[model samples]
Target: MTDGQLQQLVSQISLHDFKRPFRHRAYFNARLRTTGGRYQLESHNIDINPKMLTDFDEKTLVGVIKHELCHYHLHLTQRGYQHRDADFKRLLAQVGGSRYAPTPKKQTRLAYRYTYQCQRCGLVYHRKRRLDTQRYTCGRCRGPIKPV
Candidate 1:
């Protein structure tokens, strides 16, 4: 959705759930990696991960919005707004907001540290860490494992 749409949704959710208005901006932030949304302490703006929409459904989106709104409204009202705060927890439960943002899929690639070949069957093996070739053997043909 567009930024305007996001702003509207946040406003609606704030009014509907919290009975308060969300005057600050809410926008999709592509730079957000893992968390579904974040409430800025200084700017008071809410940043939502664009990937949330692509990966999840409307219910999930609403939950995330409500979660951020909890932070927003509490902070504005001079209440406990942090996750560890009792006021934040109570408000979150009342609004049925998600406790924690869903984690995004990890994109880091792992490199193979060792390569082994079966002495008799010629089967290749890949591993993330070095393995003892003397102890481990090929499962298919019971052949000795040799470093390749």
Candidate 2:
């Protein structure tokens, strides 16, 4: 969704869930990596991770929005808004907001390319680079290692 849709949704969720209107901007921020959304205390604005929608689904998006709204509403009312605050916890649970954002799915990249096995012990080791079989020996049986 565009920034306009996000803003409208945030406002709607804020009013519907918290009974308060969100008067701040809510938009997707591509730079947000580790978080689904962030509520800036300074700007009172919300920055949502675009991946929340693209990589996941609208359900995940709504959950994140509710979570951030918890922060936004609590902070504005001068109540306990921090994660450790009881008010935050109570409001979040009351609204059924997600406690934590879902982890984004990442592309799997195999880092190890080469595999070495100890013939005697049947132990295996994976290495990103080729191993020097002539110099390395199996730790388990002190046997010669071979490329597998």
Candidate 3:
């Protein structure tokens, strides 16, 4: 969804669930790597990770919005806005906000393309890239190696 739609959703969720009108801005933040959303205490704005919608479903997006709204509303009203506080926990539970967002899957690959054996000690090494035999040697016997 776009930033405009996100703003509308956040406002609607705040009003419908918390009985409070959210007056601040809400927008997608691409720089958010690990967090689903962040609430700015100074500006009262919400920064939502775009991955919440792209990686998950609409339900997950709503839950994250609710989670950020909990912080927004509680902080504005001068209550305990921290995660460990009783008020924050109660409000979070009442609104059914997600306690934690699921981490996105990583795309790193383990591809061992080259194998080398030590001449003297017979030590084996698996690597993704080719190593210069004349420059590198085995750790155990300090012997030269050749690719297998």
Candidate 4:
């Protein structure tokens, strides 16, 4: 959704759930990694990871928005806004906000390309780069290593 749409949704959620108005901007931030949303302490703006909609659904988006709103309102009101704070925890649970954002899927392939095994001990190891099997031995049993 567009930033304007997000702003509207955030405002609506704030009014419905927190009974407060979200005055700052709310937008999708493509650069946000891992986190589903973030509440900026200085700017008081809310940023949402667009992946929340692409990877999940509307319910997830709402949960994340609620989570960030908890931070936004608490911080603006000068209450305990940090995650560990009692007020934050109580408000988050009361609002049923998500405790953590879903982990984002990696867009790029993993770098690991090689696997090595100890011939004698059957110990396995993974490496991103080619291993010098001749030079490296299994520390477990001093056995020769071979690429599998």
- TM-score per prediction, in order, is 0.71, 0.71, 0.73, 0.73
Ranking by lDDT: 3, 4, 2, 1
CA lDDT of 137 in candidate 3?
A: 92
Model 1: per-residue lDDT, tens digit, 51-108? 7888888888899999999999999999999999999999999999999877766667
Residue 50, candidate 1: Cα error in Å is 0.6
* CA deviation > 4 Å runs, candidate 2: 107-148
**Residue 10, model 1, lDDT:** 96
- Provide the overall lDDT of each model, using Cα atoms, as 2-decimal numbers: 0.91, 0.92, 0.93, 0.92
lDDT of 4 by residue, 1-148 (tens): 8888888999999999999888889999999987899899889989999999899989999999999999999998899999999999999999999988888776997668898999999999989999888888998999999989
Separate clash counts for every candidate: 0, 0, 0, 0
Cα error of candidate 4 at position 70, Å: 0.5
**Per-residue lDDT tens digits of candidate 3, residues 104-131?**
6554767888999998989999999889
In terms of lDDT, the best-performing candidate is 3
How many residue pairs of model 4 clash at the backbone?
0
Decide which is better by TM-score, 1 or 4. Answer: 4
Q: 1-148 in candidate 2: lDDT tens per residue?
A: 8999999998999899888889889999988888899999999999999989999889889999999999998888899999999999999899988899988777588989999999899999999999899999999889999999
Q: Which runs of model 4 end up more than 4 angstroms from their true locations?
A: 110-148
Name every residue pair that clashes in candidate 3: none
